[model samples]
Target: MRLPLTSRRSHHRSVCVLLSALLCSGLACAQASYRIATEGTYRPWSFKDAQGALQGWDVDIANALCERMKARCEILAQDWDGIIPGLMARKYDMIVASMAITEQRRQRVDFSDKYKDTISRFVAQKGTRQDVSPSALKGKTIGVQRGSIQANYLSQNYKNSDLKFYDTPQAAELDLVAGRVEYILGNMVTYYVGFMKTAESANFAFVGPDLKGGLLGDGNGIAVRKGDVELLSKINAALAAIRADGTYDRITAKYFPFKLM
Candidate 1:
């Protein structure tokens, strides 16, 4: 009961075609896998949980975008200062570390459309002078994260003030609590959620008016190496898709009570 040679040959060809299709699909999945970088010390944006797993607004947003793109992502915690350099070195495809979209940063890396907006502020002991003017802060000591927009703003405007820069936001907060610094400057939302709301920050309050525009930058964006148009395009598209489908809102709700964008 052997089949005709022609029939057997056709069946064999069909199997070969099926196998080839399956192999191609697998290859496509592997190709889509990407490495993404984030500043794990920045809480409510990107930070490790008690279990040491990265979980925050930025990480969730990155995950949502990857889902829209149908890509597999490996999120890595990178130091803030080295995040861009790592991307340029091809260590990661892009950075989802809530980096601001600024003229200075744009010279080194391209960015996706902003996913969130933010303002900077100064936090000091409740009884301290609330003025953020340069003259008032002239001799005061301020703790700020190194290379941040807050640090830049203070350096340019409050030149007479003493600026103490730290490698991470948490370090700055610790210094502020210990009274080593007269004030601390950082994102309003971060301080409100990560520090202000904490038990240790009970005596501290936001002093300055919300600082926006100028050197503060417009909003937070995902960063990619300069001239990485293809990856930038994909990130922008996925970001748009997630926002339109409500995935972005859902993630934001988990971390913030107010709209960031």
Candidate 2:
């Protein structure tokens, strides 16, 4: 007996599908796919431009790591208010955002080795020089991003001062511009490249010393859910590869004039 043409084609299709699945498992399609979450409101680290597309150092680094790992990566713009909670809900597989590696955060998620540093900075209207100490800022209102190390530092050390925490850095910047706050605490690189150098921020200048380590903990790192140890290891390997092969430097130079990593 001879098979009908339609049946012959159906049998061939099944075999082709099986072969493709086998190939994907072993060869050209071995690359993994991951979804990354970033707080898109932090400019120079991550934010949307006039066209509403995401950009900045975090986006660049995330893409680079995805490439090095041969993985398809999708980045989502999540609000800082619920970023960590979203991760716990399995909304994303990783966080390539400029999240600091603090002990408190480690209890919930695992982090790759420090891929970048975090330096706190204080900015105010030009010629406004405060000592950046409890005595200097006493009774003054300072602006900080809520749930950030800067906010934590202010609450812990400058208890005498009134600290205003915003959901995003841009909101804090707005308050600073409107004279709602005496000073703004933020990331050093961002305060310089994303704001102070711009014409609108011409009236603003950095005051006090660059801060690191203490309450800020270690540097920035990519974060994964706790127990996702295998994925965390792979991310660290990609980070190391990019740094050694000059990919890291190339990306860093595009946004910052100085070495930040």
Candidate 3:
């Protein structure tokens, strides 16, 4: 049954009040609960399984951190582009969507210490000889996820390449597989686990050395809104606790063949 309009407004206010006490307050606040937001489409990090249940390294790590903090936690799916705005609007408490910790992003929101470090690499169809250098890849089409550090990297390093930006990395992968683009730039671990492990990717392989530094950022971390110092500190501590107790290792093993932390 639907509630009266007044009742609905009251409920909304109550939710915000509760969240403010916990999310925007000092760690000593009484409310011990929070909601974590994820893109829920990044494979091996935070994606739904065949059963439609959310399952991935990021989900597990968020859950583990919540446990260590003795807090009530809910992992919610959100669009990648709006994740940060949602956090700022109090729609969620934190972001655990394999977002990199970068200086540009830091201006908008704070981030916890890195939970995993992955390198950006180039992938292309096998038997294609190409160099990632600007002059060599000139006129060659490249696919990259919009708003990602990889896109920034491509812009800075390969200005001569024709760049196609997709909202999701998966879209870029689809374009790469369909021969729409000669190359794709993204995290090495993501491509390996999400595509390269599959039979369809048999013909595709790494085309150049892994790219790092300058624009790619440090690594993936839990993101919270700026000025939310108390909540951020607690999350950082919880992240450390999970790693110390081996929970982080277990989650990484489930999705990746190599260590990310």
Name the candidate that leads on lDDT: 1
Q: How many clashes show up per model?
A: 0, 0, 0
Candidate 2, residue 185: CA error in Å? Answer: 0.5
Output the better candidate (2/3) by TM-score. 2
Ranking by lDDT: 1, 2, 3
lDDT of 3 by residue, 145-187 (tens): 8878898888888888899999988899889989999999998
The sequence of per-residue lDDT tens digits that candidate 1 reaches over residues 115-192 is: 889799899999887788999988999999998888888888989999999999899999999989989999999998
Question: In candidate 2, what are the lDDT values of residues 114-214, reduced to their tens digit?
Answer: 99899998998889865878899999899999988888889899999989999988789988998999899989888887778767687988889879887
Candidate with best TM-score: 1
Candidate 2: misplaced stretches above 4 Å? 1-30
lDDT score, candidate 2, position 91 = 97
TM-scores, one per candidate: 0.91, 0.87, 0.86
Which residue pairs in model 1 clash with each other? none
Model 3 residue 156 CA deviation in Å: 2.9
Worst 10 residues of 2 by lDDT: 22-31
lDDT of each: 0.90, 0.89, 0.87
Residue pair clashes in candidate 2? none
